[model samples]
Structures are given as structure tokens and as C-alpha cells.
Target: MELVFCLLFGGPSMVGALLELSKNSKDHVATSTAFTFFRLLEPHVYFLYSQYRFDKGDIGRLFIAGLGSSMLLGIIVGSLADKQV
Candidate 1:
């Protein structure tokens, strides 16, 4: 199904994107730029996903749900990274 495909494909690319955004030293050229671009453009991706029957409320709600989950995980990972570093 398309939802499975979306999850399988979008999940890793999204994680890789966030990892790249969080790491990388060349702030002016790569990480910051990619992060900004992704931040600016991500709404469009969610907008497309909102057209699906599975989506409730709207794109903003869907994105916020994802953002909430990501932040929870990010906090745990960030804490672990701090201990490691």
C-alpha cells in the first residue's frame, strides 16, 4: 500500500535529513542551509499527505503530531549524545 511505501521511504530520508541538520560543522554552507530549506519546504510535503483519507484535521495537525514525536525522541537522543560527548 501507498501508506506503507510512504512510511518506508519517507522515514529514513527524514531521519537522515534531521541528522544532517543536527550535525555537520560547516554551518554556513551545508547544515544550516539544508535545515532552513527543509523547514521552509516541509509543509508542502505534509500538504500532499493531507489529501490522503487517513489524514484528519489538516496538514498542520499532522505535522504537529509528527513534530511532537520527533521532539520527544530528539530529546532522548540529545541527552544520550551529551553523555557520550
Candidate 2:
């Protein structure tokens, strides 16, 4: 179900956004910044998720922790970006 939804909706939207970003003046900077940020964070996120003991019946707590962490990261990054701009 998730894969199907992503294929039908998220896939196209992401493709469209990428295409639009590519044509923009700051495409290189925007793409490189995004790629760099994801590259830096992806490993840490994967490590954290892999280390989490889902079988211990803490799946809900893990999910909430992940969600909160992501939200906090977004807020911090957004504020930093705003300050830089």
C-alpha cells in the first residue's frame, strides 16, 4: 500500500519538483546542498533506526522519537537557513 501510494503520488510529485528545480537559476546550489545534507544525515538516521529494538514492543516509542527528532531537525535547519538568508 505504501509503495503503491508513493508510486502513484509521491513519485510523480518528486519527479516534477526535481525537473522544476533543475531548470531554476540556482539549480546546482540547491541540488548540491540537498544532496550534501541528505548524504550526511542518511547514515546517522539509518544507524539509529537499525539500532532501535522494534521487537521489544517499543515500536510506538521509537516511531514517536523518530518523528520528534525529525521535527526538531527541520525546525533547527529552517531557523538556521532563515538566519543565513
Identify the candidate with maximal TM-score. Answer: 1
Inter-residue clash pairs, candidate 1: none
Candidate 1 structure quality by residue, lDDT tens digits, 1-85: 9999989999999998998889756664655777888888876686667667546566667778899999999999999999999
Report the lDDT of model 2 for residue 46: 53
Error at 50, model 2, angstroms: 12
Clashing pairs in 2: none
Q: What lDDT tens digits, residue by residue, belong to model 2 across residues 1-85?
A: 9999999999999999989867856554445777788879866755676687444346557667888999999999999999999
Name the lDDT of candidate 2. Answer: 0.78
RMSD of every prediction: 16.5, 8.5
Measured with C-alpha atoms, the lDDT of residue 69 in candidate 1 is 92
Candidate 1, position 18, lDDT: 97
Computed on alpha carbons, the lDDT of every model, listed in order, comes to 0.81, 0.78
Off by over 4 Å in 2: 1-53
